[model samples]
Target: MVINTGLANLNRYNLNFIIIFFYYAAIYGTIAVFEENMMIRSIKDIILLVISFITLFIIIFKKQQKDLFVLFVLFLFYIPIIIIPYMFLNLSEQSLLYGLKITILPIVMLFTGILLSNFIKKDKILNCFKGIFFIITATWLIQYFLGIEKLLNFGYEYGINVKHFYGYLRLPSTIGTPDGYAILLAFLSIIIERNIKNKKIKILFFIVSMVFILSSTIRSAIMYWLVAYITLFFLRVLTSRTKFIIYSSLLLIFVPIFLFIMSKVNNSLFSIHSLEDRLSHWNLIEFDPFSTKGIIGSGLGSVGASSVKLEEINRSLNGYAVDNQFLAIYYQIGILGIIIFLLIIFYILYVFFKKRSKGQLGIIIIIGTIVSCLFTNTLEIYPYNLYFWFYLGILIDEPELIETEY
Candidate 1:
């Protein structure tokens, strides 16, 4: 791909303006925190909704194609799938609201990406993203060295306590937690690598980002980075024999060795205990709509992090945080919601594969998202979801016949 740094000549898209919402969302991990301040939380939600509607209006105004229409239909169909049961199940008001936020946020983010794709040239978007990436990474680095997170008031307010792993402070930077920081930066790093023109510079950036990822001690981020790199490698190498050899090595040798190392680390990054906790959460098959709740779920916000907070206010709920996004859907939305959600993913992946050439970077980034979603609620949660959907919009919103110009 060609690196287009000649931003001066390109038509103005000012699409970079949208980054503020994502920046704020991811920087603070507000949805996970800020439970005490309803006013602040409400403001954040309103900002997201407004931005989404504005982007949706742009997509409609610009004359959307069948693909966009299909997305629209899916978005429409999905609401009732969650909402209908939410109402009928007589779930707590908090659950309903939380459900709506997660459901609507991604759709809005999708539209936002579509809008950006239609107006801004890809090169410009990449150019602007580099600026954002550098700023965020630098801020994170500064926060780490200074032993302070108060650079942003909200950052200090909602931030998780600084964690120490391997005798170094686990840097959450402005994002509140190490896992949260790593997840967002991991995705952004892919975009940065795609955008940066110099190979040495790109590798340096990768090293720096990996430092943060490792220091943070978020095992899922490490797993995501490894899986994405290996997948990217497989995609780049063409020979079947080479592919087979690599696969055999990874499966037969590398994975077992890696697992052994993880076992020894006391599950520092991804421990057996961590795996057990995740499995225990998934063991809530009894709560499955097919098994219990029927067509609708207990309610929207009833299952995950939001449920934990809502539970305080409404003690009647058996709200437990489900680490897995897919299972979270089943527990909160029910059988039909889970099925519809899965179908949506299948359809999106099908579309992604069909247009793989047009959005190779996007495809690779999404593969990471798919893997991360299984282990973490990053996609369903805020800030993380913000970047996930926004980047996703940029990736899949390709114009037909749009091939990489480079």
Candidate 2:
């Protein structure tokens, strides 16, 4: 089941496109450093639209007729779920388009990943990821130690202020936000752990990843990393009771130390107070599932990050800042939409479980992502969201493509 690692059988055109797309996605935040350049910022959106259209073309004209039909049926119902809500809510065209793009991006990237699995070598993709990991690690280290204000101010223009905890800046690196950067590190760490066989190098990479993620001070990402590693350990690396006992003993030893550190921080940022504020905010947002509008939704772009562009609507809806990804979907698309979203996620997990090849990493990442969505609108985040869906398609559809380089 090993996938060929050579480019001889690869589709050069598709490989080039995927390479461009991923590399661009990797550096997307750096592009935002040029705050004065509107066109440069817009390139992210333009490239996204191009990818979406290209995905549509692949769906329409590619040889996977059965998959095309399934996708067609899925979107046949899915598009109207988005559009009808927009029309009913009388939202602006800009909002509608923006919403549409954000909502469908996962699907687009999924197909793109499928195309990637077929057209490109897995080693090439892994190499891209490794390269991205080093570059980001270097930049993040520089940003954190040097206090690079420009990098720190990356997302301020978008109203996302730099975060701080205990006199330390929650470094965003080049990813524009600490949370997004943390998410990226979580995924990269998994890839590094699974692919890199050198024990010392793997441990070094893990340590650096932890430091960077910890520097970000994103509790969810930190938890995700913990869970992903534990899942990987239990499922793949170790199957013996002794191994479990050893892992449990380590957790027992570290849990108290970790709690002590949290207690000492005394900052509300990582404390239960922050979580209470989130829950209280969620309580303020009312959606009557029994109502007609609730059945469909308030509309796309009526909530979450994309709604920020719809100033009036966003204001009227109290900025529509449903931080939880699931709640955001429910706010925008209603009960049916939420149901569809859950079904998609569960279905993917189901497939991964049943197929259960070398995709334990994928399963772990997906599980971590699901947990992450509970705390933040993960799908709304750039690069993380793109990588999330892209890897979903690749690892799930072509699990064999994920091979250990060592």
Candidate 3:
């Protein structure tokens, strides 16, 4: 019986490893040749499906009742938001397919996170992530010194695809794009700050990480880091003096640096043009608050990546990409959809805040995520959403669960 139990545990570990391996692959594996390839996208979908299936099996086999319950609750809550909008909006088949791909793909991450916490130690997870960050950051630096395109076929769109404004090359590292790299490091910085023990080492890491993030030229990432700093202060992790010093130092050093970079990138750091464009996008939303479509929404795929494809299928769609998450839901899902979305986010906040005593890193990560979402629909995008749900699982799970033997 002991041997049988050991075998089962080994099987569990093996399955968990596969899920995480593929999860990261799906996030960080960038091949420009496959950018618009349907086959490559399908393969990624298949991976997510397999991970979800294995996660469900393990949850059932192990009688992880709490996990099962949470999964059920999320599915139940999201059903109307996804379904009603699709139906009410009459989204095209292509659009529906595209929308669901982004919307549903990351559910696997939640399960993966749950299973990962159960099977692995936090320290082990941290070490593994550190290795990944190092590899990616090194690649990013290589791209900066020697162009990524010259080094390999895999090149950042900004660093290679588009003409660099002036000589600036916004290196994306392995995270696929400039914005993605910044967002990724934003979340990573939280984890690093929380896990590192030595103050001087932590400070060094912060300086290095911030440099990488700023070099990405993603203004939202800059905002995310600032918000994270303030959030950490509110959590009492940083003393008032430390906060003031860090803020002052970063502002003095990086503000002009970002301004100069943005100027060279053809976008000013304080570019009113960009802000106006964003506002114009928001103004395009025309839902009738009293109408059913307005109340429930157009549906999941009605507004984003899938929506663009939908325009090809139905000319009336003329899909627009609203970088803002709040507006995206308001346009696609309607008022009820936004309500449901807020409720879900609030629940995540509640869980993290409740468990903040033990999950301070998780709390900060979620806070950063919410802040980022305001600007870029982090919950709707790939990898970013995956990270959000993944961390949510980590935050909500009982501490005792992670302590249990695999």
Candidate 4:
């Protein structure tokens, strides 16, 4: 079963296809079955755990990768314990069910192994991830063409209305929610950017990603994507504090004021209910100094605030959770736990920002993603976080592991 990959390029071994297929199957397939009641969440959990750990163990014990591999596994185990409390928290039976996300362990671990395998060959790794991204895009388009992507949204006032076909097609493209997909696809422009080889290709790619985003109708994600894209695209503008301050004052400050004035004059013309919900949800944060739950907070998945919020939102019309990552982590782990979670994320960001050698733009997108998740809940979902870790682990690993000072 062993094969030699002496050259360490994708052509040497076809692991890219394997990784891509498993990734989408697990992510989207699980989503398709999640609501259908066919596959037990526990079964997918177990299979991924087996595949993930088996891959990690083989890599770690193998002669070529003992130290780095072991350290990597430990790193994976160490950080996510931030999420382990829901099992014991004092919460309702239904609230406790939310802890099923611990199942995310296997998926993260599986990607971890992919990271370990990919470190030896960075291009293959990137290619594989890009391939998976395209798989999602391709499959979605296929479904769209078949008319299967069509579904209706039950409007509270207007009954069921035709909805744009997007994520949740086959794989739970949850993060790829109409807006979320746009953001990822827009970022994909950075992924596929070549050596400034051809002008037409770049313009075409940019246009296509934009088309995807605009049609998605996720205003929040779209706004975020546009802002992040502009910032990263002309990063040189931020190279100096004076320049950043000047630009921020003029663009950031005036743009909002102008938009506000226009929206007021136009009666806030294009408001989406989802945006209203997000704005309304901000009150829940309210810089609440008074902690609701004490240490160990309302039992990991207990009914403290989230259930109340759900009742309020009516399970986002059976969506079952908030769209804010910060809230999601905080509700489950409490403020202290969220701090730990952010610290882990901050560590990754710090590394990327400090070491701009590893494709700085990609790192920017990665960090931007983490930052964006704080305002919205994408990490709690699979695939996004899984892909984040996979890309990040390899990007960081592409360079030699720096030795620590004694």
Candidate 5:
């Protein structure tokens, strides 16, 4: 692929942005471990806001593509839906700003991805992610061997405690949580499956990923990865007869082992109480046509991990950490906002399906994320949320950029 100097520079700039996002959590974790000013972590949001404005500026002045325009419009329409809820709820100004920060930044990232897709080559994107995966995996391994005391020191500044499962410390690595680490590993697994041609190397990577994911002890992440890979296996990895044989062999050989392992993990692996608690919490948020909260929601930033800092708002709303992404949106934005969000998501999925040959990886990841969202607020999770929207933009349309063989 031949590239002009300007385009090459743009590509480098865009790639650097992605790298920054990929390591944002790790950098914060390192700083926290050394007892540096924890407020620096909040700088990430400021940087994101700046990037959003820059992207908006560029889209307005340079690239006015019809699709991009439509997306911008949809987001514009959804903004009011959320704002009205905040007014009705009488939330503080700080809460409103926080709401806008979380909601708008991800949408801006989608714009960034679409605009930069042509400049950044597909192979370069994969290679960048591959390097990131290896580096993060190394950190995870080191953290695993560091013992709980050392790991606890890593996030104590942020009030994040070390989590354990079945007497094993859930390794957060450079990421802030085991769930985040596992989710990142799961995403890397999809990329490896789609791009790596060497059978032995691919198998090795898969084994590493699986071991780390299991070590994290995040059932939702594990389930998301399994569902995504199983779908990929049938769609791309094997012919019909081969798929049947391989699947049958897998069940026969692995199911017993899996069951045995689960028995050992017991409550950690299968917690009925946790499941019931989640369901009960979900039930508590159900929409009521007669209620103001049901019609317009409690308002954006009314409840969520971000809202926890707003002690008065959190207490008034009786908000704990909302585990479900969809429910979190519903609690903040109301029914209309969620409907618009779902429509946008489905619209993106439709575009992905239309270009399935080129976008199958996107399809698998989106499906996996949606499933993960049911059990956890995947969208609120840093880096994952950023990359998720960015990739959706990258895969939404066919880029005319040079492509190398997968």
Candidate 6:
């Protein structure tokens, strides 16, 4: 049984290498072509994550071996269960309704990955982006035909796309915008993570991805990528190779400091707005926690009574939707909601990094995505959700077993 299990794992590992190549083909290369396929864009990460979870539960029973932090995820996800329904009953609103659409993907995806940890093998995520040249070239051509490049540079208004939050246009390209595409590259690193043999590949991936992020001219995207990359670099120095504890410690310190500085710096080089507007957006608009909602919240899509009407929540915030996920979530779920959301993040990072798992790439990508999302609403969109889960599917299994057992 032991030998058979080992062989099966090896077989799956080899297959994953092939699967990942096509995965990134859709992610980095295809551009708007992937978007052309509406059904593809519609698929959510939660679906594959669910599959991964079921696959793992039946295989390893690695439940006992799962790191302490990840072990808590099962229960943490349920926090929304109580809050979502409660708000619906009390608030007489749709806050919970919209919030549900936004969060359900992550909750389902993460849960599936957690549940199926055993049978699934952790894959180095490289093959995912293997066909980048072909896919990207093809998509760029299509964009050319559609005049998307011109359309994007100037405005989303011309095309079917719409500009939202902070006066930025939204693209539905292969993986999406500068942040979306760049983060995908960063996330793709999860597959090549930490292996001395593939360090070049991973570093190169980071650089190329950053370039795409820059093209967006979105200060938030640039800042988020910078912070995540810098954090990863510094964390690498302190880490003792596979030293999980050191990695986590450094990440915690670096992230908050980086975010705070970005949030505050007045003469911040290359930021999106002038000093006055930036400050007003970041500091002045204090995240008004709906007092009445208390811990539970106003309801998934419930409306608020103060400042800006709850119905006009997205528009009143500056004729744009909330760019910050933390604030967006807080508004929907309240303080308890924020607390629950954060705890999940803390736990996931703890579990993900601790295994000294081949998730170094995944961690970086997640951090990059998180930082980028702070500035752009990547979480609420389509292909972004689909791509995030695909990356996640690679993250749930154990890479050690795949490499060693094979």
TM match of model 3 to true structure: 0.79
For candidate 3, give the lDDT of residue 14. Answer: 58
Q: What is the TM-score of each candidate against the true structure?
A: 0.80, 0.86, 0.79, 0.65, 0.86, 0.61
Ranking by lDDT: 2, 5, 1, 3, 6, 4
Question: Which residue runs of candidate 5 sit more than 4 Å off their true CA positions?
Answer: 1-8, 33-39, 153-159, 234-267, 309-319, 399-406
* Residue-by-residue lDDT tens digits, candidate 5, 163-207: 766566776666666777678778876766566677777778778
Model 6 per-residue lDDT tens digits across residues 1-406: 9966884685466445435534643553234433546356334333444444554454345433454235345445545644654745544434444444455434544444433344443443343444543354355345545654575564433323323334443343454444444344444333333442565665775555554444444465565556665656655655565556766677798878866774664223345464346335645333555455555554454322221233343433423345566655555566776776677666657656776635555566567667766655555544345446544544545544432100
- Model 4 C-alpha lDDT per residue in residues 1-406, reported as the tens digit of each score: 1344542453224355436534654355425433435355345545555556655665566554433444455456534443445455433555544443432342354345344554355555556656666765675464455543233211111111123322322211323334335455545545554322467776786677665555555454455556655656446456688877887677777778967874675432255665577768656543442455433344443332335434544542222355566665555556665555556555556655666543455455655666566446645434444555555555554433321111
**Candidate 3 backbone collisions, by pair:** 85-298, 85-299, 297-333, 297-334
* Highest lDDT scorer: 2
Question: What TM-score would candidate 5 get against the native?
Answer: 0.86
Steric clashes per prediction: 2, 0, 4, 11, 0, 28
Candidate 2 lDDT tens digits, 333-371? 888888877777776677677766466767889888888
Better of 1 and 5 by TM-score: 5
Looking at model 1, residue 354 earns an lDDT score of 81
Alpha carbon deviation, residue 111, candidate 6 (Å)? 3.5
lDDT per model vs. reference = 0.65, 0.72, 0.64, 0.48, 0.70, 0.49
Q: Which stretches of candidate 2 lie over 4 Å from their true place?
A: 1-10, 65-72, 148-161, 236-270, 312-318, 403-406
Worst 10 residues of 1 by lDDT: 1-10
Tell me the deviation in Å of residue 370 in model 1: 1.7
| lDDT measured at residue 237 in model 5 versus the true structure, 0 to 100 | 40
User: Cα deviation of 281 in candidate 1 (Å)?
Assistant: 3.4
